[model samples]
Target: MTDGILVVGDISARAQAAVTGVVKALEKAFNAKDPIALSEQFALRTSWSNAMGTRLDDRRSIAESAAPAMEGFLCDSYARYDVVKLLEIAPNVIAVSVAQTPTDSSGNPIEGAWGATLYVISEQEEGWKIVAGQNTAVESSSA
Candidate 1:
């Protein structure tokens, strides 16, 4: 990987903005602890792998499971998401990769559990939605 952020292919500013909006929206929903909203960002029949490598089979199950997961760790912490890269794979599809870190709500750093997520977004009648995604925990560099 290069030192600078790598954005491959051509996604116009507007399209890029919209494609990236999915991440922003996910961040907002997670921060707000709105699992329903968060799950709504995904495609109904698709799957997502959480940071723990657990496969979530569908939207309903994701939403069902996310509520408590949010309350458990996320509701008490502040999260930061950085887009590592975005690739335009097709006319109306793009893949986004992100780095995520979080601290306690008080801003105290929590050791470990850093994560990287990849989201494949596709255009829907409503807007862009995550057609597929995977979130995996990253070990500390010194680990």
Candidate 2:
């Protein structure tokens, strides 16, 4: 559905709530460093692939592999998303593009791996959640 306005459009209440839920859930999960909670935002058969060549399909596996990075090596600044746009590609599919950046533990800006995450969400009884995603890292920005 088109909102008629630029970024704001005629989005269904359920869809709007779903999008807001996903965004808030992610922000909280990352800030809390809770991988399990973070995994809940995705469906059981989600796929996460990054530019690092790491390709994983299972939600649990992705969470496990991300533990250390989310906990130690990286600064408290974890995965952050600046949603640029959202579009309903199909009746059951939604595509969202976001500008991602890494921050320090205090949530301060850091110069590191920066890229974009293009996610495709699917409608579920519980609401819309990510079913598949492709992460492209900013090669110029070193982590």
Candidate 3:
């Protein structure tokens, strides 16, 4: 017997592409250590939490908070972001999950520094902007 295909509700491909594009932009900005460009990916009034659990509200706060890290300890660190899942929660709103792997200056993956980030993005007048997000560190299990 032949198996039937499964369908998971209707989601616009255009919207998915746009949302993915925004994430790609963020990854690019982060790799470049450009705080301004990174903040531009978020909405004016946003709720964001970093891996260290620091909460930042609004784009200005996000920029201010990230600038120091980008120029300090994290200066030589880079990361690769991969969109793991995308769900359309509501019209024009998308919930996205991404996996992040920290890497060194030479693109070597850092040990035990993986992270996962969840972002709630909305399609605004300008484009898809992250309205809320939280980044959590993924602990490595020792066998």
How much is 114 displaced in model 2, in angstroms?
1.3
Which rank order by lDDT, best down to worst? 3, 1, 2
TM-score of 1: 0.85
lDDT of 2 at 99: 69
* Total residue pair clashes for candidate 3: 0
Among residues 3 or more apart in sequence or in different chains, the pairs in candidate 2 whose N, CA or C atoms overlap within 3 Å are 3-9, 3-10
| Alpha carbon deviation, residue 29, candidate 1 (Å) | 1.2
Count: clashes, candidate 2 = 2
lDDT tens per residue, model 1, 1-143: 23344678877777777777788788778877899999988877677998767788788988988988888865575666667788989987889888877666554557757778898988888778888899877776221
Q: What does the lDDT come to for candidate 3?
A: 0.82
Kindly give the number of clashing pairs for every candidate. Answer: 0, 2, 0
Give per-model TM-scores: 0.85, 0.78, 0.88
lDDT of 2 by residue, 25-80 (tens): 87678778888877777777888785566877977887887677677864356656
lDDT of prediction 2: 0.70
lDDT of each: 0.78, 0.70, 0.82
Candidate ranking under TM-score, highest first, comes to: 3, 1, 2
